[model samples]
Target: MHGKIPMASYDEAVASKLRRVSTDSLRFGIIALIAFLTLVDLFAAQAILPSLVVKFSVSRATMGFAVNASTFGMAIAGVAVALLGRNIDRRNGIWFSLVVLAIPTALLSITDSIAMFALLRVLQGLCMSAAFTLTIAYLAEHFSPGQAAGALAAYVTGNVASNFFGRILSAAVADGFGISINFLTFAALNIAGALLVWLTLKKTDRMMRIDADHPPVGGAWKAHFKNRELRGSFAIGFLILFVFIGTFTYVNFQLAAAPLALSPMALGLVYFVFLPSMLTTPLAGRVARRFGPANGIVLTLGIAIAGLLALLTPNLPIVLAGMALIAIGTFLAQAIATGHVSRVAARDKAAASGIYLASYYSGGLVGSFVLGQVYDRLGWTTCVVVLVAALIAATIIARPLTAPRV
Candidate 1:
């Protein structure tokens, strides 16, 4: 009888151990945290742009391009990873890329020339792309099919959260300590990201080693180019960021220089505008499902145009309201357009995404320079007019993104 009782206790203990080992909640948190660290440094530089201009003693346009040069490297890395990711080990690539990322982010503090600064920014972009690319792969491999959707949603929420909080942190650190120290703070976050991934993430046995039998990129792209919906999506993807980057980049100068005269900390807090976007963007897939991608694009970009017009208001509250609308509209539009790309490509979908991202970020790089010149020469109102025109063009391009008339 005693021996039988001991066996029952042993079985109960085993069952309890199995129950204790559930990692679903932990996995979601880890994925979101790592994504946040990966992208926290991306656009945070914009918060400190005024300080950087003073530090480098350079033109606003020059500083703007240098600050945005990260997009250039990101564009190249997106395509490279799409082609080469099958060979990369997701577990090691994510952690190691973050470690390397810290080096460039730290080095940014000591750079003295615009040329070098831009180069380091490019390096940062490369490391971030590798980490982000591999993380997406990791999610697909690690999570169950039932859990993958929620996991991806968590990762994207982290990215959006970083955009909102990262800038605030950067501005606060620069205001209190110094701009150089701000880079060091970000470097430390990079190290934390590496350690987090190293400790928690696991490798999957189901490796997607497909380079041995992959299709030719040149042939695939040619086919993708022939599709009208794909073509329209690619263009909309480009124009979305063109207007977004243009409006956000130059508006800082206007806010800091004139009647508003918001301090660095205050300007950083201005990104509170993204809160509505954070809330609204998660519903983008639902919006597309209900209204269809074509109508979703038109509806959201219409909100953006209304926001651009509101920027002409003389009142501060109205101006902030305008910025909030732009954030909500553009972010939702981007989510819709990105989802459209995934649907319309039909084959080599990863490569199609790579092409779309390259075009999207390239628009940001181009917008930084083009709109900087516009702001410097023609002033804020002309810049708003230019952005409004860009959004209008994007709306026209998105019209053909569907076959059935909407």
Candidate 2:
């Protein structure tokens, strides 16, 4: 009887362990889906930039600025969230922002005026940034210490997957149906994302309470700026996105024009370049752990620089190789830097996320305008030069972008 009882207890314990493993897997899957939906819209539009340029009858620079105006809104919203995030409900804010994001996404289907298009993009950005900022804070609050690293790695992997699939989805939908259909499809995705978060995420009141003892959020920001490692991370984030926007945005025009006039379907297929990055990004934590964060970033930057230089070639296969290399390198670097920020910001992680995201997206905003103008005037060759230089500069900054020393 005693032996039977012990076996029963052992079996019951095994069942419990299995149940826990299943729950954690399910949780990580949900996190990855949420991350994918949250960021899909950010770069998807670039896939169809040529069509928009023709439809709007605008210059490439003007169209680039208008399409990328969302980044400016993200930059602004990041700062706002950084300053006021301590008072927010992470889960509720995330779902609500995603719900609002759908509205502007739907409106894009009908907008004909370039100005209105840009405005909608800005509004979309604001909602996306709000949701994004809150989602990061949500994960931090909800996950355990053991789960946090895996959860974050899943999120970053989702981010990279979104880059690949979002552009493909955008291009295929726009080509198969129409541009209007593309925006509407994305609008549906935004709502679906809202539903996912609303349904799966539980309300956790883990926000830092602002009593008399806590310093003001503004003071926190001031201190963040003063931290050398944080500053270096911010710089690397800015430069990475700057180079990314320059390469992907203008490269679309290059492919859509003259010698290599890839169809929308083909352009979408080309974003398969992001596949390698998606595979590599989830390993970022492992890489950083093995080689150290700064060394990892420097190594990745070297890959990106090599890729940037390869884009100077007029050959289609070589250009695609460059894109793949760039995608892999930048994504690995971004993932490592993101993890570093989350670790190093010991005091105000939410506030740090906001400022870091702001700097990151601001680079996209600036790069869109600056590199678009460069592409419009100086051509793809000169634009590649600028991108390579930015990557080189990022390598320099990445040396100090590691976690803060204890």
Question: What's the CA error at residue 97 for candidate 2, in Å?
Answer: 0.8
Q: What local lDDT does model 2 show for residue 368?
A: 93
* lDDT of all predictions: 0.86, 0.88
lDDT per residue as tens, model 1, 212-233: 4546878778877888888888
Candidate 1 worst ten-residue window by lDDT: 205-214
The candidate 2 region of ten consecutive residues with least summed lDDT is 205-214
Among these predictions, the greatest TM-score belongs to 2
lDDT, candidate 1, equals 0.86
